[model samples]
Structure formats: C-alpha cells, structure tokens
Target: MKNYFLLLICMILLSCKKENKKNFDESIAAKLYNKAKVFRNSNVSDSAFIYYNLAKNAYLERKDSLGVGKSLVNMAILQHNKQDYYGSIETSLEANNFLRKIDDSTTRSTLASSFNNMGICSSYLYEFENSILFYNQALKYVNIPSNKYLYYNNLGDVLITLGKYPEAQKNLSIALQTKDSLKYATFINNMARAKYYENPNYNPLPEFYKALKIRQDNNDLQGQNSSYATLSIYFFDKDKIKALDYAKKMLEVAVKNNSKEDQLQALQKIINLDKENYLENFKKFQALNDSIQIARSKAKNQFAVVRYDVEKIQREKAEKEIEGLQKNFGIGILLIILIGGLFLYRKRKKRLEQEKELEVKNTQLKMSKKVHDVVANGIYQVMTKIENQEHFNKDEALDELEFVYEKSRDISYEKTDNQGEEKDFSEKISETVSSFKNDEVNTYLAGNDSGTWKHLSTKNKEEVYQIIRELLVNMKKHSKATIVSFRFERENDLIRIFYTDNGIGISGDVIYKNGLSSTVSRIETINGEIIFDTKIEKGLKITISFPAS
Candidate 1:
C-alpha cells in the first residue's frame, strides 16, 4: 500500500512538470499577436503597440523570423497612426531585415505591408523620393491585387507631389483598374490632381466631385476630409466664398472624425478665406496645432517607454535564467575551473621556456645581420672595385677596409657607426654605384640628386644604401651584363629606384638566397617594396619604392 502511494505521488509530479512546460508552447506567440489585433481594432493604440512588441519578442525567442516580421509590421502601423513617422520608418526597416523573399504568401504579404508602411511614413515626413522607392518595393512583394493597387496609388500620390505628372498618371491609371470602388475613387482623385498640376487649365472639379460623392455614400470620414480639402483648394483663387464654405465643411467632418491634423488644415484655410472671422479661426488653428504637436510628442515617448520596459523585462528574465543555470552547475563548473587552472599553469610554463629560446635565437640573428651588412658586404664592395676598376686607389680601399673594421668592432659593443652619415646621401649613393662600375660594365645614373634624399631619415638612408649595395652585389655575382642603369627619383612623398641590367635575366622564380633574403628584409624594415622582373628575356629589371620620409 505504501509503494502504491509513492508511485501515485511520482505520477502527479510528472504531470505537473509537463503542464508547466506548456507555458512556452509556440502557440503562445500567435495568441499574443491575435490579442494585439483585437486591441488595435478597438482603437487602444498604446496597448496594441505594447502587445505587438511583446509578440515580436516571443516570436524572436522561438526563432520565428516571419512571425517577428509580421508583429513589427503591425507595430510600425500603430506608430504611423500615432504620428511617429520616424519611429515607424525605423520599425519597418527592421522588419524588412527579418523577412525573406520566398514563395510563402503570408511572408510575402507581411513584407509588402512593412514596405508600404515605410512608404506612408516617408510620405508623411516629406521624403517623397524615398517614399516612391519604398512604394515600388511594396508593389514587388504584394501578391494580392488590392494591395498592389494600394501601393500603386501611394506611389502615384508621391510622384504627383514631385511634379512627375505623366508618371503619376500612369501609376494612378493602373490603380484605377482595381475593382474596389473606394480604391478607384482614391486613384481617380489622384489622377485628376496630376492632370491639373501638369496643365493648370485642366478642370479637375468633376472627378473631385465624383470621388467626394462616392466617399459620402460609403460614409468614409477620412476620404470625405481629403475631398473637402481638395475642393476648397481648387476654389480658393477662383471663388473665395465657395472655398470658405468648403473649408467650413472640412472642419466639421474633421472634428466628427477626431482628426486634429485635418482640423488644423481646414482651420488654416478658413482663417485665410473667411475675413469676417479671421482672428477666431486663427486662434482655433493655433490651439489645434499645439495639441497635435503635444500628442505626437507624447506618443513617441510612450512607444519608446514600452519598448524599453519590454527589453528590460527580457534582460532581467535572461539574467535570472543564467543565475539558475550557474547554481545548478556550480560544482561541475568549479571542477572544470580547477582542471583549467592546472592546464593553464603547465601551458604558461612551456610558453615561457619557448619565449626564452626565441629571444636567444633572435639575438643570434641580429648579430649575424650586423656582421653580414657591416663586414661581409663592405669587403664584397671593395673586392668588386678591385676586380673592375683599372685605377683602384690603394689608400681609398684601405680606408674602406678600416671603416668596416670599426663597424665590425662596434657590433660587439652594440654601438651605432655614423660614418656613412658624414657625406650627402646622394653623393654616397653615386660613389657606391660608381664603385661597382668598371671596363666590363657600363653603369649610367640619373635623377640621383641631393634633394631626392633630403627628407629621408638617417636610419632609412642606411637601409636604402644597404639595399642598393646588395642589389649591385647580386648583379655582379649572377648577371654577366655589361650595361647597368640606376635611376632615382622622388615622386610626391615616395622615393623610387629603378635598376636594370643587360645580363642573363633570372628565369622562372627569383629565389631569395645568397644575401638576397637580407636585402628583402632591409627593404621591409623601411616599409618598401621590391619587384624583380623575370619576364625580361635578355636583362634583369628590379624596381624598389619606399616613402621618402
């Protein structure tokens, strides 16, 4: 009997756990979205916006991109209705990021709706060009004919505002083909306005009256306000009395519809046309305009607050979940940390030993480079002169040998030898290249002026000198050419050196070896590039370029 009681308790506990898991079921997001629709239909815009935002987050948590796009579209529409045009555009753009261009009808519809809302918001903000582009995009995604007509009408309206009357008429004509009577009225009214704007002599009153009659029959207060405003504007210059009467009718309709913006518009026209009550109408206009501004500001703030609150709740919920996970895995995490700590200690010890070995190797390489540059290359330059020049001065060669001796000695003491800095760098470069010239090789020099090396630093000059010397040495050893040319020029902030030799050009890849690697390294230290032209059939051409400073 006791065993049976324990089994019953276990079964009850399992059932409760299963019930709790149902709270996060995917259907919850759909329910929230439907609830938001109900609120929106009931005219509770703030509540609707909040619920749509919530639904978006729930869909995001489920990784449902399409659902998130749909929710954001509704949120944007709510913002648009609240006169938050900028915020509505931003939400619509974000919704577009989540929507895909697929064959799914629902996804395509949601995408189309998002773009259409953006177009409407852009129109409200007076960004007519951007509004046209967004409307065209909406048309591309709109599978339903009614939606296509709506986008076409919107595009035509903006095009008319931009004075593209012919284009506007084309789009409006397409929209007028729709079977929907209300849409036809909107399209025809827009087409008439386009024609009148294009040709001031065109009479749009007939079409305007027809649209007004249809809107009145349908009891569309918003459409009636549009028609009344249009009629008032049409009669304003022609007959002030008729314009005033129509403006008065517009104000009545706007007030009945509770649209502050339309009321403000009508009041402005009345103040302009009705001289008998100018001050009275002006006061009403100012008060209505102020109230509309305040309401729009408050709506923008409320939307921000709703989004902030939702994000805050989500963040706090995430933090709590993290905290619970941390608690649940506390011991496991502690053990992992202990193992990681031991592993890091061993790894750090090995890294330190490796770093020390690398430091020693780097020191050896530095000394080897100094020897090669100061001693070996110095001797090679002297040898080349001795072998090439008919009148090689013994005293000058001895002096060069003595300078190399001093530089070599300084390497052990780690002292810099500034002997190369005693002469103008251009003269030094000319003398160095000339030393490599003899009866066998004819060397030509151009653009090696003093101003070419004026802005070069002492270290950079040294690197350039060494690189030129290395190239000449490589030429002497490898290329059996007779003619060699060294051209130096300063173009803007860059110093370029072009070397050519009429010798057996390097075939295939120019292998970097036999001091050539060090030449490349020295060029890199001064932020320079060297290109060896192996494509030449008869001669070698090397170009070197580096910043002058």
Candidate 2:
C-alpha cells in the first residue's frame, strides 16, 4: 500500500509541475505582448518588433494560437512602419492563418487588426484590388467603432488612388462622422487630397488650414509640417508671395524637427518661388538634397547589416545544433587550432604597436591641455588687466610678456616654455589664481606653499598646476564666482587639495569638457583621485588627492 501511494504522489506532482510551467509561459507571453503594444504606441518600432517576436516564440512553444496571432500582427505593423511592405504582408498573412484556425470570439479584434494592416501594406505597394479585399475582410471582423472607421479611411485612401472619386468621398465622409478627434486631421487631409484629385483647379487652402489648426493645437509636429508643405505647393502657381511664405514656414518647421527630407522639399519650392535668386538657392538646395540622400542610403545599409547579423546568429545556432547531433568535431577542431595560432601571432604584434602609439598620443593630448589651461589663461588675464587699465603704456615689459605668452600657445606638444622651471609650488598656484581674479572675485590660498608640497614629483607638480589653472579658468568663464578658496593638506602620505568657489554651482547633468576631462585623466595617470560636490547650492567644491611621490 505504501508503494502504491508513492507512485500516485509522483504522478500528481509531475502533473502539477507541467501545469505550473504552462501557466508561467502563458503569463510571460501575455506580458511580452502587452509591453510590445506599449512600445508600438510610443513609436519605438524596432523595440516593438523585438518584444513581439519574443512573445510569438513563447506562445508557439506553449501552443497558444491567440497569443501567437496577436504577436504576429504587431510584428507586421512594425514591418509596415519600416516600409517593408512585402514583409508586412507576409507576417500579416501568417497571423491571419493562426487566428483563423482558432474559432474564438475574443480573437475577432486581433483578426480585424491583422487584415487591416495587410490592406494598408498592400495599398502602399499599389495593389489596390488586394487592398480592397483585405479591407472588406477586416470590416467583417471589426467590432469597435475606432477600428471600423480606420478601415473606412484606409479603404477610402485606396479608392482615391484607384481614381474612384465617388466611392472614396463616400467612405471618407463616413470616417469623418466618427467622433475620434485624434484621427480628425488625417481624415480631413485625406478628403482634401481626394478633392484635389477630383478637380485639378480646386484651391484646398481652407481644407489645409482646417487640418493645420488641429495638428498645431495638438502639437503634432510632423502633421503640421506636412500641411505647411502641402499649402506651399498648392499656392506655388497661383500666388507667389503666399507660396514663398508657406514654403519658408515649412522650411522652419522641417529644420526644427531635423527632417532633412522635408527640408530638401521645402528648399526646392523656395528656390522656385524666389526666382530672382534662383541660381544661388538652387545650388544650396541641390547640395543639401544630395547630402540627405547619401545619409539616408548609409542608414538603410546599416539597418540591413544589423538585420543580417541577427539572421546570421540564428543560422549559426541552427548549424551548431546540427553539428552537435552529427558529432562533426574534427574539422572544427582543426580550424580552431589553425585560426588560433594566426590570431595570436597577429594580435600580439598589432596590440603592442597600437598600445605604444596610444600612449604617445595620450601624452601629447595631456601636454596640450596643460598648455591651454596654464599659459592660455595667464595670458588672457594679463591682456584683460592691461585692457582695463586707465593708463596704457605700449612699451612696457608687461606688453612684451603678453606677446611672448601669445607666441607660446602655438607649440604642438609641450607645456608653456616657463612651465618646467623650478619655482615655489604654492607661489605658482597663487599666480595662476590671481590671473583669474578681477574686481568681481577675491581669491585666497592656504597651506599650498607648506612642507606638504616638497614630497610631490615634478610630474605631480605640473599636473597640480594644470588642474588648478583649469579650475580657475572655468570659474572665470562660467561660475560668476565672488570668492574662491584653495586648501592643501597632507594625510597619511596623501597630498590632498581642496578647492571651493562661491559661484553658481554646476547642475547635476553638466558634462565635463576637455579641460576638466584632461585634469581627471592626468590625476589618474599619476594614481590619484578627484571628487566634486556640485550638489551644494550656489557654490562649487572639489577634493583631489594623490600619494606623495
């Protein structure tokens, strides 16, 4: 009786385990689908596609037809967004096949969406009859008012393309009656387009303004710019001043949005409108248009390469599985041995040379920063002091010093000519600080010239000089500082420097530029650390420490 109980308990546990796993997989698939929808609504097309694929694969493993169908339709929409019309059609058909096999009332909406996407994709490819068929099928399954109106709009667009004006107008009129304000502008614009096609000489200015007002009020930048371009073209042959005004507005919108394609289109129209300067404007327009085309081509190629890499990874995984089953180990092993030897041989030689070159380049850049901070700021301050003088003497020694300092800035990879000379470390810091001090700010130094400066290396001294000089220059340019303090301390063989300024402190998001960046690198090169306390309101505080050399 104990043995029978044990067998029955094992069977029950096994069944429960499978049930739990199925529930887990179903939940994960549902979550992924929901997340994909969110991303889709936010216009994150690539991310939406990725999550949809993940959900589809999970649903396929669980044999969940409804989940798989929904994922496929979402992916199809993403493909449509990417302008992959054929791929969109294929994905939508696959989704429809899955949805059709499952006879569930809840799946009707998903089926409707899939068929609607198929219709849109087909229409984009100019397959009007196929588009109409898909639209009709979507209408049969669509239960919601919003989707029903969308189908009507899509059908109207295809009918307009097919030159069936009466049918297009009828469908568009029906779509306009739906109280969905989000789509109101688009429907209005489509009706205007149909009207334009119906009558060649019709002025669609009122219709264009009606759509533009809605789009602008909603802050729909792309829609607003599109309306500007349409109005510009509509007025191009009728009223030159109005055409130029709209074209200029379109250009402004396009530039603001960084839409190079629309900018190119607007520029072309502007050149046509401004006939007096046609040649000049046309040249500029052509150059920008060509550049935009090249950039777009490069982006398309990059996307293709990314897709190829993903496909390659999937192919390699399948190949690995096949090889594992076959146990085809000899060829791979031989190739690995040969490739490994060649790789190591090339890698060692190249890496050593590259490392040497990088080290030299870094040193040059560090020296450049030091020169810019120390010599450049000192000379600029002296020039400012001289310029602010009530009495001027051109023959003074200070003028010669200024000239020499200006000349020193031209060198390629060395600190200022006087930088390496042995001088009192604290005195040098004081001099650098005083250069940035004007009537607006008072500078003070403490413990800088004390015995703690004695244990520092020449390199350390130079780096310290550069770092302090950079801080002063930054304070002068940005800080609006009233008072500055410099404090030096020694603790356990660590030379610590503290700097503070009563300036408008940096915000949390300020990025360090070349001067501060190089200071950090220089300190790190000498095995030191620096920290900033910009969170302090209305003041900047910094602490830097390096071991005494």
For each candidate in turn, the TM-score is 0.57, 0.49
Candidate 2: pairs in clash:
none
Q: Candidate 2, residues 1-549: lDDT per residue as tens digits?
A: 134533432332233223477887778678768877897899876656656776777688789899889888888877776656677788889998999987766699999999999998876554568999999999999988888888899899788766677899899998898786658787888788788767877766678889999988988878878788778767765788998999989888888887776787787677657866644564565456435433433333333333333333334344445445445555777667655865685577568557755765565455545555554555446556555875643223233332333333223212243444344566566656655543246677787654777667787788888788767766765787878889989877888889999988886567375137777888898799999887787788999999987
Q: How much is the lDDT of residue 171 in candidate 2?
A: 92
**What does candidate 1's lDDT look like per residue over 1-549, in tens digits?**
134523432342223222444465367677778888998999988778877887798788778889899999999999999888888999998988989734588999889999999999887655666898899899999999999988999999888776678999999888998998887888889999999878888999899999999999999999999999989988876899999999999999999999888897788678667766644664565455445544555576668767865664555455455455656777887757755865686588568657755765566566666667766777678767866998775445544553454455345334454634434576667656765664245567899877788768889988998888777777776788778889988889998999999988776455475447888899899999998888877988888899988
Candidate 2: Cα lDDT at 360: 51
lDDT of model 1, residue 200: 82
State each model's CA lDDT, in order: 0.76, 0.69
